[model samples]
Every structure is written in C-alpha cells, then in structure tokens.
Target: MLELLSYDFMQRSLLAAALVGALCSVIGVFVVLRGLAFVGAGTAHAAFAGVALAYLIGFPPLPLAILFGLATVWVTGVMEEQGRMKLDVSIGILYTATMALAILFIGLMKTYNAEVYGYLFGSVLSVTSEELHIILVLSVLVLGLIVLFSKELYFIAFDQEMAEASGVPARRMYYLLLTLIALTMVVSLKTVGAILVFAMVLIPASTAYQLTHSLRHMTAYAAVIGTTSAVGGVLLSYAWDVPTGPAIVLLATAVFFGSVLFSPKRLRRIVA
Candidate 1:
C-alpha cells in the first residue's frame, strides 16, 4: 500500500476514487430515500452521451456532460412534478434515447477515440492531474450544497407533501435534489464510468440502510463503506492487474451483500 502511494498517478487515482466514493454515497442517501434510483441511472447515461458528443465535436467534455445530465433530470423532474407523465416512463425514454445517441456519436467518429471509451468503462489509474483537480472541485461544490440544504433535502426525501405543508418549498427542493443527482452522476462518470456509476451511488447507501434506521448513521456508514470499497478495490486491482472500475464496484457489491447477511435490521426481523 505504501509502495502504491509512491507513484503519482496512483495517488491521483486513489484520491479521485475516494472523492467519488464519498460524494456518491453522501448524495445517495437522498437518492435512496427519494426513490430516484432509475433517474440517477438515466442521468449517468445522458452524461455519457454528452461526453460522446463532446469527443465527436471537439468540445470540452465536462460542460456538455453536465448540460446533458442536468437536462435529463430537470426534464424528468418537471414531468414528474407537473403530472405530465410518470417519472420512470419519462426517464426511461430519455435513458434509451441518450444511450442511442451515445452509440451514434461513437459511430460517427471517423477514428476511434480511446479517451472517450475511458469515460464509458472507466480507467481510474489513468486519471490525470487535471482530471483529479476537476473531481476535487466539483465534489466539494456538490457536498457543500448538500450540507447547506441537508434538512430541506432530507425532509422532502421523506415526504414531499408534508414538507410542502410545512412551507419548505418542496417542489424547488425536489428539483434541487434532482440537480444534485445529475451533478453527482457527472462527477462520478470518469472514475466509475457511465455504465456502473449508479451502482456506486445505490449500493453503499442501501447497504448502510440495512444496518441502521437513522439517516445520519446511514450516511456516515455509507461514506465509510464507499471509501473502503474504492481504496480496497484500487489496491486489489493493482495487485491483480485487473480493471479498476469493476474492481471497485464489485468490492462494493460484496460489502453490500455482507451487510445484508448480517444486518441488525434483518436479524431483528428474523428473531421477531
């Protein structure tokens, strides 16, 4: 482990992974409570589509990815809030369309772009210094906002109607949550990739949920679980020379299952 930290790229990769892991799990607390799992997944694919378009048109990938991801969640939030359509149905359509767009953009490129594929499948060990800086900046921004509005976000997540009844501007807060979800997806795209990023958000929170009924404890546990999985996966990947993305995700998955097997909540249910 000490030897791995001796290298610059590995250091950047570990930092990026830890940031992504912590950010995703923190925001994931709300996502799990609000039942935004599908929407979160859709935003990731939309962000990936934007990355593809950016690579094809020679635009900066970050801006376009943010645009597409935000558009997806905003549109989904509007449709769901306005009662125009079911949230899942709207996001489902956008999800399919965005994935198709991603494939189309990739196909249109005359020559293959390996960097583009990095965003698709993730290669955390390849994280550049610039990319690490971007991740750090965005992670701080998103986490800061979540901390600022944690109460309203949590209130609405538990019961939007009740929150609105209490004058919390539930609609706006819902949009804010969706926006945060979109940004979180974009922030995590490179480290975990579009395909598996949602799992990074979902799994740790879910695992934590099984262990505690308290939101604060759940979030804290998730952060620890996520960070551990990410750093552990990086070490294992370095040792085994396997892909880092899947390694992190699979390690998180294993932790999730372990949590499930031994969860106090589950054991209480069994004893009862």
Candidate 2:
C-alpha cells in the first residue's frame, strides 16, 4: 500500500476516495433520515447528463456536472415547495429525462469513449490532480455547511414544524441540504459511478444506524465506514484487476448485510 501510494495515480485515487467517502457519508445521514434517497439518485443521473453535455461541448466534465447538479437541486426544491407535484414524481420524471438526454448525447457524439465508460463504472486510478482538487474543495464546503448548521439541520430533520417554529429557516436549510447532496453526488460520481452512487450514500450510514441510536455517533461511524470501504475497495481492485466502482459498492453492501445479520434489535425481536 505504501509503495502504491508513491505512484501519482494511486495517490490521486486514494485522495479522491477519501474525500468522496467523507462527503457521501455526511450527506447520506440526512438523505436516509429525510427519505430523500431517491433525490440522491436523481441528482446523480442529472450530473451524468451534465457530464455528457460537457463531453459534447468540449468543456471540463466535472464542473459541468456540478453546475447541472446545482440546477437540479433548485428546480426540485421549488417543485417540492410548491406542492403542485409530488416529490417522488418530480424526481422520477427529471431523472429519466436527464439520463435519456445524456444517452442521446453520448450516441450523437459518435465516439465510443473508454473515458466515458470509466466514468460510468469508475476509474479512480485515472483521477486527475485537478479533479482531486475539486473534490477536496467540495468536501470542505460540505463539512463547513454541516458544521455551521448542524443544530438547525438536525432540528429540521427530526421535526420540520419545530424547526420552523424556532425560526430556523427550515426551507432555506432544506434547499441548502439539497444543494449539498447535489455536490456530494457529483464528487462521488467519478469514484463510485452514477449507477452505484446510492450504495456509497446509503450503505455505510445504514450500517452505522444499526450500531448507534444517536445521530452524532451514527454520522461519525458512517464516515469511518465509508472511508474504510472506499480505500479497501480501491486497493482490492488494484490488486485483482477488478472494477473499482462495483468493488467499492460490494464492500459497502457487505457491511450493510453484516449489520443487518448481527443487529441487536433484530436479535431482541427474535428472542421475544
């Protein structure tokens, strides 16, 4: 592992995984608690569309994806706030539409690019220093927001009415949280791919959920689990010449299932 880190590509991959893991786990706690897992998937697909558009237009893909992701969050938040449409319906429609557009653009480009496939399935080994820098910045932004607003965010998460009653600007926090999720999805897309981004966002936090009843401790445990799984998966992929995204997700799934199998709650229920 030490020798592998000496290589620039490997170092970049590790750094990307570390940052992505932290971001995903942090945002995932809210995603799970708020029942917004679908939103994460939607934003991920939306980001993919942005990448495809970037490819067609000859711009940097990550930045384009992030921009698209932010837009998606805004639109979805507006629709949700208006209550003119159900949140799931809005997300499903937009998610499919954007993903379809991405596919169309990819075909129109008339190039079967390995880089495109790598993004779909992850080539963390191919992560550029520039991309890693973007991930680092985004991670800081996310952590900063979470730290600054954790009390209010938690109140909103637990009881939106109470949060609003307390002058927490719950709506603003809601949109802000969505925006953070968009950023998190965009950053993790390269490491875990759009298809498996949900795994990264949900698995570690779910496992932590099983281990703890406290939100703070659960968040900490989730971050640790996510980072460990990402790094381990990447190392395993490197050693075995396997795909990185699936490997990482599989590791997360393993942890999730392990938690379910061994959860004390389940055991107590069984005994009763």
Candidate 3:
C-alpha cells in the first residue's frame, strides 16, 4: 500500500479523493439539514446534461457543467419564488428534462466516445495534474465560503423564518449555498461522475446525522467518513480492478448502514 504512493498518479488520486471527500461531506451537511437531497440529485443530473453538451460541442465539460448546474439552481429558485411552484415540483420537472436532454445528446453523437462514459461513471485514476489543480482551487473556494457564512448558513438551514426575522438575508444565503453545491458538484464530477456524485454528497452526512446532533460534530464526522470512504474505495478499486466511483459510493453506503445499526439515537429510541 505504501509502495503505491511512489507513483505520481496514485498520489494525485489520493489527494484528489481527500479534497473531494471533505468538500462534498461538508456541503452535504447543509443539504441534509435543509431537506435538499432531491435538489442535489437534480442539480447533478442537470450538470450531466451540461457534460453531454460539452462533449457534443467540443468544449471543456467542467466549467460548462458548473454553469449548467448553477442555472438549474437559479431556475428552481425563480420558479419557487416568482412562479409560485413548489421547489420539489420544479426540481422534479427540470431533473427529468435535463436527463432527457442528456440522452438526446448521447444519441446525436455519430460515434461513441469512451471518455464520455468516464464522465458518466467517473475516471478518478485518470485525473491529470491540471485537473487536480482545478479541484484544489474550487475546493478551497467552497470551504472558504462556508467558513465565512457559517453562522448565517446554520441559521438558515435550521430555521429559515427565524434567520429572516433576524435580518440574516436568508434568501441570499440560500442562493449562495446553492452556488457552493454547484461548484462542489463540478469539481467532484470527474471523481465520482454525475450519476454517483449525489451519493458522495449525501451518504457521509446522513451517517454523521445518525451519530450526532451538534452541527459542528456532524460536519466533522461527515468529513472523516467521506474521506475514509474515498481513500478506502480508491485502494479497493485499484486492488480489485473495479470502477472507482461505484466503489466509493458502496463504501459510503456501508458506513451509513453501519452507523444506523449502532446509532446511539436508535438505541435511545428503542430503550424509550
């Protein structure tokens, strides 16, 4: 295992996994808290449409996908606020429409590209140094934004009405949170791909929720769980010659179920 670190690609893969894991887990806490898991899923699929568009148009996918994801969020927010549609309803409609667009784009291609498949399912081992740099920069930006707005975000996540009453600009903070989620999804797309990115966003946070009520502790625990799953999955995928994205998601899922089995909250409820 230690010998693998000598290889540059392996080292980069591990580092990328750690960055993505920590970033996704942290953002996921808010997603879980705000009951926005569906939104996360929808945004990821919308980004998938962007990826397909990139492939079709011969442009870089990540930036385009980021734009697409952000646009999806903006549309959802607008529909909910101005068009008088529920968020879930807007998300569901947009999610399906974007997925249909992705399929349509795929069909339009005259010849299938294997690289596009990697975007669908992830190709972390193939990540280049430049791509890693992009991930690092974006990860730092996401973390910094989270730190700067931590209090406001926490207030909004737990009690939007109260936060708004307190003049916290709850609506704007919510949009910022969505932007962070979009950026995180774009950075993570190469590691876990569009299909499984939401699992990376969701599972570790859900696992931590089972173990703690404190937001601080939950965020920390989720990061640890996510990093562990990412590293472990990368190692397992290398050893077993399996797909890395699914491997990471499966490990995260295992941790979530394990947490459920031994959760103190579950035990307390049972005893009560």
RMSD of each: 0.7, 1.3, 1.1
Per-prediction TM-score to the true structure, in the order listed: 0.99, 0.96, 0.97
Model 1 misplacement above 4 A: none
Ranking by TM-score: 1, 3, 2
Q: How would you encode candidate 2's per-residue C-alpha lDDT over 1-272 as one tens digit per residue?
A: 67988999998998898778878988898888888888999999899889988888889898889988888878988998899999999999999998998898799897777776666777788888988888898899898999899988877878887889888899889988998999998888888888888789998888988888899998899999999999888999999999898888898899899999998778888999
Q: How accurate locally, in lDDT, is each candidate? A: 0.93, 0.87, 0.91
| Per-residue lDDT value at 166 in model 3 | 86
Candidate 1 lDDT at 199 equals: 90
After superposing candidate 3, which stretches have Cα over 4 Å from the reference?
Answer: none
Indicate which candidate wins on TM-score: 1
Candidate 2 lands at a TM-score of 0.96
Q: By the lDDT metric, which is better: model 1 or model 2?
A: 1
- Arranged by lDDT with the best first, the candidates are 1, 3, 2
Which structure among the candidates has the greatest lDDT? 1
